[model samples]
Target: MTIAIAPIDPVGRAFFAGVVSGIDLRKPPTAAEVAAVHDGMDEFGVLVFHDQDIDDEQQLAFSRALGPLETATGDIAAPHERRVSMDLNDISNLDKNNKVVARDDRRRLFGLGNQLWHSDSSFKPVPAKYSILSARTIPPTGGNTEFADMRAAYDALDEATRREVHDLVCVHSQIFSRGILGFTDFTEEERAKWAPVRQRLVRRHPRTGRLSLYLSSHAGGIEGWPVPEARAFLRDLTEHATQRRFVYAHVWRPHDLVMWDNRVTMHRARRYDHTAVRDMRRTTLTNEVSSLDQAP
Candidate 1:
């Protein structure tokens, strides 16, 4: 099948939303096809490939074509071999037995962090560039993922607000975000592994030269600013940027592979029944090694 990319109208507005079809994700894409995929991602920021039923091996093969993959942090009870996959992260709510977790399970509570709008691994020193999530199992309703185009959001800001953030530096931490939801009891080891990192409030896409507001729920505070003022500013910016006009909400189907550029987008999971099952596996590409170095 010839691969093709088509735009999607998100409730009458499309902001970097596209649907990719006709490619067999089980096989590695040709050079031309890979170039086309990059072009779509660079322009759309979010691309959905429907009905691609690829396993972990095939998914890793295609993900490697984009860049070096991020390994799992071994923060869960999965075995050593699973953690060492080096290109996969299990984002599921299922246990080893493939059963839904009890509502009180610690893992489920920790996973609640996904409900907050954030860029993948924004607290990391190198940070994530792009992330791909494949839907294996989903509930009958809800659990949709929504993305906000920070590039457009930045453009929508008033001149004074834009100027204020252009040169500011903000600190990001996984601890801060989780704490906000009363999940404040991270083990000392976890805390040690994820100390805060500072990043610019505004980012420039190295290839497109477009500016995007680099906001995330992980943001702790602005450097050298009063803590309360910093929090207020960050909250205001988040509310302003995530308004309906800048968002694209994706409704999932079986065998769907959804990819988003983490640099220019923020995404979060919508609510669903805790008794039902939702299984998603993800592979992330980091700026430490990116496709942009070789993009056409």
Candidate 2:
């Protein structure tokens, strides 16, 4: 059956659909809806599903329908499920159960940049292909997921800037990034585990071969450049890509599910009260690739 999709933002960067259209996400979607979602996702980076009751099995099935699930690495992925794909109900700095810790954890780490804007899995050797989030519960104030269009950003770049960044490889580091923020969750063991990884600065979509802004907050420095200079350049590039003109902010509702292409977009959550008990379930899909750890 066809789903009614409505564009949520001014630029129509997002489209809203109902998962409760009574089709079981556990099973495969008809060819038509799959085609439609693919089309919609290309036009509107973020696609929202309203009021779909799904369990882990169903969620997995739904996510895998898009592609193979992304295998999370790093210490945060130590959780029984996944760091990027699973949702935490609470994100307080003081809570031992908190997946990630920081003061105003929701604002600083969880929501601050969650709302800021960067592509998913852009930091990994093989970055994420798609991410689907199911919001089971939401806070009363300030919890939104915003997406900036990397493809749009790339298209908007001055021809010179595009040429300059195109072939450059940027280094991505969780250890260096959290350290920069003074967040000390990673042990020396963790640091050693994460050697640096470099990805092409301008990402080419695996399917469409479209170039997008591949840099993100986790991007530590450039592969061959001096650290400070690389950091400065990445910061400026992010600032340019996330301009108001290229973004679409999603105000989430309970049972809202959003899926986006990780290669062409960046997104993060907005701040909400930690005490408010917000929870969500997420699943990330990976671009088809073989598995093996690599050296820096």
Candidate 3:
């Protein structure tokens, strides 16, 4: 079946987000449907599908239909202690036993970093292409996910600012993002596992050929700049990119699935009640080439 795409904005002038309908994600998609989704993603950057109740296996299958999946890694939880498979990211506040994690749980603390804007898997040598997040359970209020349109954000930059960022390279690390929250209790192994990776500060979308600012909370330093200066500059760019005009806040419902191109967007989860369960599973699509390898 063919999918339908509609702009999320009321007057249909929004440049970055759309709602996709007319196809059920619980079943595998036809080639045409897959192509339509890709087209929608290239044009919209973010796509939201509502009321499709799909489980983990179905979500993984549908995600794979779009692109190769990235293996989940570097979360605060150890392998044996994780509640979900390594193939799927467990974006939840629940422990392995399906109980709400304790108030001071290390995993929960680490997860607080999600509140900061970031591109999924930016810390990896090969960053993610797309991220599909499925909401199984959502809080009655709050816990919304916010996406920033980096492409539009780039378009809004002044000529000099754009030129300044166009050729820059930055180093990204989960340790840096988590460190921002004052959670520095990383095991030595964890530190090594999440060592910083370099990425272009500006990226060209492969399909649309549009330039986008690749800003993320994971970005701690630029290649040649001093640490303090680089971080301050990154913070300024993030603030500008996530301005109210450039962002789309998604108030999630149960069984909603939302996907966004990591190359053109940055996203973050909002605050929710720790005592409540907010189970979100995500499948990340691996980029064939890293930002380092891509044309600026």
Error of 3 at 280 (Å): 0.7
- 76-194: candidate 3 lDDT, tens digit per residue: 88888888899999999998999999989999999999999999999999999989999999988899999999999999999999989999999999999999999999999999999
lDDT of 1 by residue, 1-296 (tens): 78788889845655578999878889988887788888888889999999988888888888889888776662344364242254677787777677787887777787788899998888887788889999988899999999999999999999999888888888888888888889877888788877888777888887788888988999989999999999999999999989988999999999999999998999999999888888888999887833223221
RMSD after CA superposition, every candidate: 3.1, 4.9, 1.0
What Cα-based lDDT does every candidate model obtain? Answer: 0.84, 0.64, 0.93
Q: Tens-digit lDDT track for model 2 on 68-131? A: 7765453243455333334222222233454334455433452333434556655566767678
Instruction: Tell me the TM-score of each prediction against the true structure.
Output: 0.93, 0.81, 0.98
What is the Cα root-mean-square deviation between model 3 and the actual structure?
1.0
Task: Write out the backbone clash pairs for model 2.
Answer: 85-282, 114-268, 114-269, 115-268, 118-266, 119-266
Q: Mark the regions of model 3 whose C-alpha exceeds 4 Å error after superposition.
A: 10-13
Give the residue spans of candidate 1 off by over 4 A.
74-86, 289-296
Q: Residue 91 lDDT in model 3?
A: 96
Q: lDDT, candidate 2, residue 182? A: 66
On the 0 to 100 scale, the lDDT of residue 270 in model 3 is 96
